[model samples]
Target: MAEKYLIGVDGSEHSRVALAWGLARAAERNADVELLHVADDSFLSESVAFLSEAQQASQQMLDSETAYAKTLGFTGNITGTAVVGHPIAELEAASKRVDLLILGAHSGSRFAGSFFGTRAVKAAATAHCPVAVIPKHEVSPGAGIAVGIDGSEASKVAIAYAAEAASMRGVPLIAVYAWMAPLTPGLEYLWSEELVEAQRSAAEEAIAIGVAGLAERYPDLTIERRIVQSPPVAALVQVGEEVETLVVGSRGRGGISRLLLGSVSHGVLQALPCPVIVTRATA
Candidate 1:
């Protein structure tokens, strides 16, 4: 079967933006687009209590989204599905068959929490394929793409995905390696310039290794590498403003084994101005 692009839409402006971005990408790749809306079963009781008028309004919104998707040139085999279940579960089950999953950073729903809601976080962390969390703001067309690296196997996967995305979008790839000086006993106050320099050198080496590996795989891709002295999350968010997408591993070397989302990936998803893609080590 041909690969299909799946986009989760919840009848919000932010979701529409995500839909638009997905459509643009699908067109570029000549792939089919599927619009999915997962109605949380937990809301069924509350929705019924609100009256049939509220339910009708919700249905109307879904209809509007379906129409909008068609107007955006996604018709024919383009599918629209509305399933009653937990948002994360539905998407995760459906994502197993899709090539990519696109989601909005915000849905404007009261139940939708900040940074694309908890469901999106879960999906990005556990989905079999890559997840792109579209930012709520407007960004320049074909801006640079940034990928965070920490010299881990998962980070290398993210770097590879970012390299391909940059080549496909015809944009520069920025490989960022963020680092901080290790905290040693009694050395917190006596942290000298030498320690900082050493940390910076290590960060540069990490970035160099990641860039070299990606260059070996994608020799024709344009890449710019950077080693920054800051927290991983802060550096990614600050650099993501001018980029079209920020790619990072779901977990890094500092993350716990059982943890699904790493600190850097979580922070970038929350604060970045552009889309963020979380890639898995094996994927």
Candidate 2:
């Protein structure tokens, strides 16, 4: 069966970017594309009079986005859907059947708490499949793929996904591992150079363990290892600025809940430098 990519479209420029990205990727994988637009039923539930108008508006959005998708010159199957419901709930439920879910990143006060903005983060956190959030701006020219590694099972899964993507794109893969020295308030002056070196060595080992099988798995792929002595989010963000796409696990070692996004993942979403892919290990 051909792979399928589900994209959430709201007729905004951001969603258009996501639609284009999804179509290009679908063309590469020979996958089908589905464009979905959901009208908030909460606002219309109280007024049955506006239900028809809302539905009509939703269908118009679907039609417009569908027309836009066609202009992109994608030859694959494209399906457009319009539903009256909660955007997050609809997208989350649909994610189960699709190979991947793609959305556009929207931030700032105008999009605050809306599905185009903060809700996208929530959807990524709870979606069953891997979610790719494409930013509005273009990525750095000639940038390669980058993934964060922290020795967690989730990070391991992310590494595998990123490696496959890099191989498919014929681009190099950069595996980044970041660490920070323990800063005990009272012992700040006792920190020594040897301790810093030990931490650095440990970070190297963690990255090594994180990418143990990449060389054998992806023989033609070039891998770059980055060890930074900073917070994981900061290091990944810096790498993101230089990469075409930044891939990260939905949660890391410190995450205990399956329904929540980890701090690092959440942080990167807030300050996205490029397209970000949030990968979750399948249960």
Candidate 3:
């Protein structure tokens, strides 16, 4: 079966970028693309007349987006849908039926509603499948793929997804493990250089374990392992700046807090470095 990708469209520049990105990926993967536009009902009273107007507006927006998609010249199957409801709730519900959900980063437009901004983060975090947040204009034309690793089941799943993506694109994969020395309250004076070294060693081990068999699995793929001594967000963002896509777990191990969807994922999104794919562990 062909893969399916759902995209949230709001008739904004950001959503247009997302639609373009989704269409490109769909063509490469021979995946189906679904464009969704949700009209915010909260802005109007629940009167029947108001609801009717919202429905008409929603259809108009969907029609425009559908027409826009055609202009892009995508030959694959494309579906356009519009609903009069909450964007976040509608996207979260639709995400379960698709392989991936793609959305554009928030652009501070009230017309965009929940398709971007903090709501986009919330949707990505709670979605049932992997969510890709396409930045408005920060994608590197032909950079490699990168994934954050921290010795967690979530990170492992991310590694698998990133590896497959890199292999498909025939691009190198950069696996990064960022670590910082653990600090104890009131024990700051006891901290020593030895502790820092120990932490560095552990970070290296974590990344090694995280990508143990990638080489053998993708013999033709070039994998670069990076062990950085910076905070996870900073490390991932710096790497993201130079990569085509940055893949990270929805949530990671508590100790490292390297890829927690709530904090780390949110932080990376704020940077808007590149297209970030937040993958959740499968059941």
Candidate 4:
């Protein structure tokens, strides 16, 4: 089978933007595109005709999106698939077979909590491969790739992927490690400037060590390290605005064994200024 890049399309502008981005990215990576449309099974019990009509409409939408992709200058092989079932479950099953899963950040349905719903978060965290969630925005010129490294297995995977993406895009890679300095409740007044500098230096050093091998791997890729003294989500979102893509671990609750969608990665998906990719570590 051809290396497939699957995209979930709902005819929303957000989904269209995601399709466009996915097409270009997949083309650059020499992968085929599969446009998937799913009809909610909730209405399947309404009537047989309703189910049939809905499925037909979904197939039409997938065809429309496939046609639309060609208009966007995507000349690669494209396939459209329509089905009736739970959207998340169907997509989850498809994810195992595809090289990558691309999704629109925003959904028109009120059921989806944010731009990405609860299920989207779960899918990103649990998918077998990396999932790229594209916001309703275009890539800006000269923007670099940003990845968060927090000394976890998932994050290490994310960093490596982000570095490779940056290398492919011919841009720099910004590796951000957000940290907070711990202070004793009553000993705050005794803190010195040297102590603050040491903490900041330690944070930077940690990030540097985390990506030490990337330089050798991608000899021509430029890697910049940033140590932020704020929450991880906020730091990554801020960086996302200035970068082309924000890549992060699907799960990392600031611990070794905690490999699941945490608040930071969750927030970045919803509010990041650029496209965000959530990656799972290789087993």
Q: To one decimal, what is the Cα RMSD in angstroms of model 1 from the true structure?
A: 3.8
Candidate 1 residue pairs in backbone clash:
105-116
lDDT of 1: 0.77
Alpha carbon deviation, residue 194, candidate 4 (Å): 4.1
Model-by-model lDDT, in order? 0.77, 0.85, 0.85, 0.81
lDDT of 2 at 251: 54
Clashes of each: 1, 0, 1, 1
Each prediction's RMSD to truth: 3.8, 2.5, 3.3, 3.4
- TM-scores for the candidates: 0.85, 0.93, 0.93, 0.88
Order the candidates by TM-score, highest first.
Answer: 2, 3, 4, 1
lDDT, candidate 3, residue 208?
85
Expressed as tens digits, the lDDT of each residue in 19-136 for candidate 4 is 8889989888888988888877864677778878888888887888788898988778888889877777778788888988998876456431122555566668666778888877
In the range 5-61, model 3's lDDT, one tens digit per residue, is 998988888889999999999999999999889997767789999889888888899
Better model by lDDT: candidate 1 vs candidate 2: 2
lDDT of 3 at 231: 91
